[model samples]
Target: MSDTPQSFENFKLNKQLLLAINEAGYEKPTPIQAQALPLALAGHDLLGIAQTGTGKTAAYLLPLLFKLKYAQGKHPRGLVLAPTRELVLQITDEVNRFAKYTDLRSVSLYGGVGPKSQIEALQEGVDLIISTPGRFLDLYNRGEIFTRDLKTMVMDEADKMLDMGFMPQIRSTLEVIPVKRQNMLFSATFSGRVEVLSQEFLEFPERVEVTPQATTAETIRQVKYAVPNLKTKIHLLEFLLRQQELKRVIVFTKSRKNAEAVSNYLGRRDLGEVKVIHANKGQNTRIHSMDLFKAGDVRILVATDVAARGLDITEVSHVINFDVPLIYDDYVHRIGRTGRAEKDGEAITFVNPAEAYHFDKIEGIIRMQVVELSLPEGVEVPPTPFVEKQEYEREIDLQKRKENPDFKGAFHEKKGNPGTNPFKPTEKKRGNKNSKAKKNRSQLKTQSKYKNK
Candidate 1:
């Protein structure tokens, strides 16, 4: 072992793994690989704290491959868990690439489609398993997967898994696996929650932090625009896409509806083969969209947070946040899609009035203010509609109420004010009530006069 394994050869990896690494065009060890590989190769449970695109994948993969040189028995010896289907597929591809020269077999399991093929793959036998928590657990419960021979378990994007509320599944998976197996957890951000998870999962694990947690990549140039509303954001996005510098881009929206809207708008405008992906999209559709983007057939990809974690496309030139992520930590992951592997990239955020607060939180988390760029001259700056404005104000007030229980939001009005109740027809109801009262009084007076006569 060398003090600084500057090159891949310095690690003394297996010949087949080395050959595959070389063929994949990896010249030297990344900072994470240089630091973590030695410990991982020595069979220590590792807690690697490194952001996406820091070569963390290779840091763990190389050692695991080296230890499990070839396919052993029918059951898998190595298990890797990711948070998303895209990530599972990405990991599967990387596993195939790195294990090309060896006889190792890998299978990826995720829930969007039928599990028939996945069950078949598991039955046929594999050396490695890359999967999402739910699908893997589903198959396991059905007696489709056998984990008796599992020797290594790697949890990639551990923080995202926790954020996605997969802790129970992770725990259940842990219960079924052998307690004597090696455990490895890698995450971009090591928050308190992740630390707690590590305590339960790892045994005296060696902590490795290549970069500070919740920090954005220095290679990315971040900029922001304060648009009036969603329509203006769309206009500005179109204007930006017209610029030739934005060659390959991913536009991130907060909701599936927005993702589809942006993708359809770009497609209608002929903005260079736009494709949309979200939870609603079919499995094959999502895979095909990603394939098109990766192959350069599509210039733009519109996606929700599903694409924010563990998507490893290195050639992405730009990341546009069509809507600021409500969860501040997600901003880091969204921009991370670009600025990967020491590459220069740009991340532009479109902040509408409603999203400004969320954007501020993101800036606070990143510890840097994004340079506010003026809206392009040609783009139409429409006035925010009353409905949209009220919605924005309502959301802002809700957030404030969360921070301060005594705070009254914009939606709050005097308790007795009928006008404040939007759902009630105050004017119409009031007039009808007065007219009915007057008619009843006249009828009562006439009935009294008739009785006296």
Candidate 2:
């Protein structure tokens, strides 16, 4: 319990884990690892509050590896649940890397692919099973996997799991697993939802906060550009990518359609081997794209929030937010992809008028104002189109209505006659009056003809 920052050796971790750690070039424990490792090793239910890339993975993995030094049974002794397939794979890779010196076997289970391989891996015997909740449940329900022997259950990125509406699955998982197992929950930001989730899952847990909640890494320089529309944002993106300093960039859009569109735009513009990844993409495609980006074969990777949480590429020089994430906490995870491992990086956000409200919320959550910069002089700043302008206005008005239910938005204002109720029957009544007058005229004409005869 020395106040001085100590090396990994001081943790008294398994020699095999120490060898792997040294080989991985990890000399000193990160703030999170140093604080959480001892408590976790001591078998405490832990609620660790720290952002991604804070070595939370290692914090949990190291202690778990020590406890399960070698593989013993066909059933998994360690279970790690993540929100996305990418995260499942990432955590699995970390396990493989750390447990290299041991006989421990681990497998990653996620959907979007055949389960035959996963079932086979489980059959062959795995000590650790890293998985998404759905695929794990699928396998468990099919009797292809068993978890009665699970000694440790780690919920990595627990906040994201809740954000993605995985609470029910997590609850189901809780019901299936042994109630006596150790529980560890890690999150970048601890929201009210996470607090409630922790209450249901964790015992009187040791609370570990490496930094203040929802705080962005100081290593990343954040800036924003108020582009007028999507087209302008694209032009701005192209302009920014032209700079030599912006190498190994990840452009995050809010939707799959935008991710693909951005990738196509960049590819057409010859912006150096662009790749796109979203839920729609095949599992192999996502994995290949990630590999290419990691190898520097792809210069820019355009992605949605699916890749926001657990991507561990350390050399990302820039993170461009083509669309401001509506979920403000996601903005923290997005920016976290860069400025990882204490490397200085940049996070640039393109905020159209429609997204300005979301951008403000992001600022509020991060507790710092992102410096708004004027668009680069040479870039063509296109005018916001009529459709986009209306959309932006409507979004703003909707947000206003949410805040003040009585406040009628601009879109709700009466466009025609102020005194007239558009939903009323004034037109129908006028039509009936005209018809009656025509009938009276017809009767009068008949009477005139009879008098003339």
Candidate 3:
């Protein structure tokens, strides 16, 4: 532990753990893993600042599993709480991989399915539990979870947890657990809310940051296309997918509606095995879709921001932003889906005039100016639909007004502002034009007053 280890064998890990780590395809530790492993194995409370796909799951798991060697107790000795069901499953997969050679027993609890199997697994026995906050709370409230033996607690994607309004559940969880334990919190970005959570969660913790907060991966080649309409965006996506090298791709949309539309469009176009996942999809359906994508059955997976944070599917060739994310931090997660495991990746975003404003915010958060590319030839850039154009204009106006309260957008210009609009008359001319109407209003007011009297 005194010197930096170039390989996994250099770490003070058990024979069984080393075997599992080797088979799991880990040669050397990721930056987060490298820094956090020693601190965590030394029984220090760890605060890991890392985005998704940085091998953070293993960062906490390696040290955690090393300590829980051979699984002695009936109740869970380690508990990892994540924001979404997908992430819980993801962490569970890694735990299984890393603990393959050990006698460790881990159970994953999530929503979308009945808890019968999970409760049965718990009743039998488990050394570790990976679960979503809501599902974990549900099980705990029903007297299903035994936390008396929980020596280590990990909260992954803490920032996303706050965004999803899991703070109350998280607070309740803290009260229920044993007062003394080793706590670890990992977040992609440490916003104010995450900082507050960290203050309450960690006690004299060792902070390990593998990357700057909210920064996108440098390995990703990012490009933005100024699309005029949804149809044009679809055309551009088709154009990109037509290329033979885009073997595995994930198209991230802003909503379930858009995800479905894009998926359906691709499916009909005979684009290789397209599937979509969002909140509207059943849990089983979503899981099945993810499995298909991971297994190479589905070449294209259209998703909303739900899959942005923690679902780890490696070697994803491209991440296409069909719509700019509403939350700026999500841009990091969306692109982080690619460029995984330090591999070169590509991210292409389709931004209309309305979305350009949000994309600009994304660039600001990532601290880099993304390259804007001209539309490829043969892809028809059709005229934007009237309704869509109006919506974009309205959105742009709202963004402008949000930034500057004094902004009188082109759509909302005062009718009498002469310089602002060529056809509009001066204020004096407007007052003169309405002078007769003003007198009529005064006469009506006097008549109404007399009537009241």
Candidate 4:
């Protein structure tokens, strides 16, 4: 790690790997790859702190591939566990790319699909296996996977695995994999649990952190729209998407319902071909949508946080947060989808009044303010619906209680205010339910809201 190897040849990589990297147009190592490849080549257990688009995949893959030069056994000699199936498939693609010249073979294991084909692939013989922890353990329990030959084990996207509660399955995996093996854990952020697991299992790993945790790429220009309700947010989103600047966009929503709604809304309009992906979708459908987006057949891809991590789509022009992510860290990953390969990109977030508190927390983590833009003229934004306003107030109150245990919410009576509930809306805006419904809804009211870029 003293001075980064200026060229890939500095590591003395096998000729096959060199040829592959050359053909793939990778001449120099990225920051993460520069720091990580040497240590991995030296047979060190690696703990790499890197976000997506940092070439962390190749950082470990090169050395791991060198160790397993060619496929020699029926069982896998290298194993990688990722949090999601998309990530597993992505890593499998990298393994195949680097191992293309060599006789190396790999198979992907994940849920939402039958295991019969995966079992058949393993039976046909593979040098490497990339899988989600749950699917790996399921196959292992079924006596389909053989791990005695494993020489190296990697846990990619470790933070995500912890977030999704894969610690138990990971522990079970530790009990089964061979004792004498190299371990590597790469993640964007390290939680307490991830730190403890690395200490207990990784055995004094050579740690490499390429950037600050949760810090966004400088290549991404960020902005936010403060709107009153979901209905208005949709209107602004449609207006923005109509602009010619937004070529390839990924719209991130908080819920599967929202993803489908947004997809349906855009599908009925003049917005380009739109596709939505969530856990509820079948695996083939999700894969098909991803392929279409990557191939430029689909112009807009709507998704929940399920698509936030491990998606490697390149040249993404913008990432739009239709709903502010409740999990603060997800804001980073959602925007990370764009601004890859040092290309300039934009991140646009829609923050309702209820989500402003969470958005503030997100800013604190990223250490920068998202530029606040004024709403564009000619777009009609409706006022906040009473039912939706109630939901927002409830969410805000819940957030306050989560931040502080002794918080007396807005619904609770205050000492100085002699009232049962202190948060009653003005009668002019929120009249009786019947009267509110009878009024002609014209436009949404907002303090601020847009960027042409």
lDDT of 4 by residue, 300-416 (tens): 999999999888877799999999897888888899999987889999999898889989999999889889988789678888887888888888888888899799886666678
Q: What is the lDDT of candidate 4?
A: 0.89
Ranking by lDDT: 2, 1, 3, 4
Query: Clash pairs of candidate 2?
Result: none
Per-residue lDDT over 50-169 for candidate 2, one digit per residue giving the tens place of the 0 to 100 score? 988888999999999898889897999999999999999888888888998999898899999999999999999999889999999999999988879999999999999988899989
**What is the C-alpha local distance difference test score of each model?**
0.90, 0.91, 0.90, 0.89
lDDT of 2 at 361: 87
Q: Candidate 2: misplaced stretches above 4 Å?
A: 1-4, 415-453
lDDT score, candidate 3, position 412: 77
User: What C-alpha RMSD separates each model from the true structure?
Assistant: 2.3, 3.5, 5.8, 12.5
Best by TM-score: 1
Worst 10 residues of 4 by lDDT: 442-451
Candidate 2 to native Cα RMSD, angstroms: 3.5
Cα displacement (Å) at residue 207, model 2: 0.7
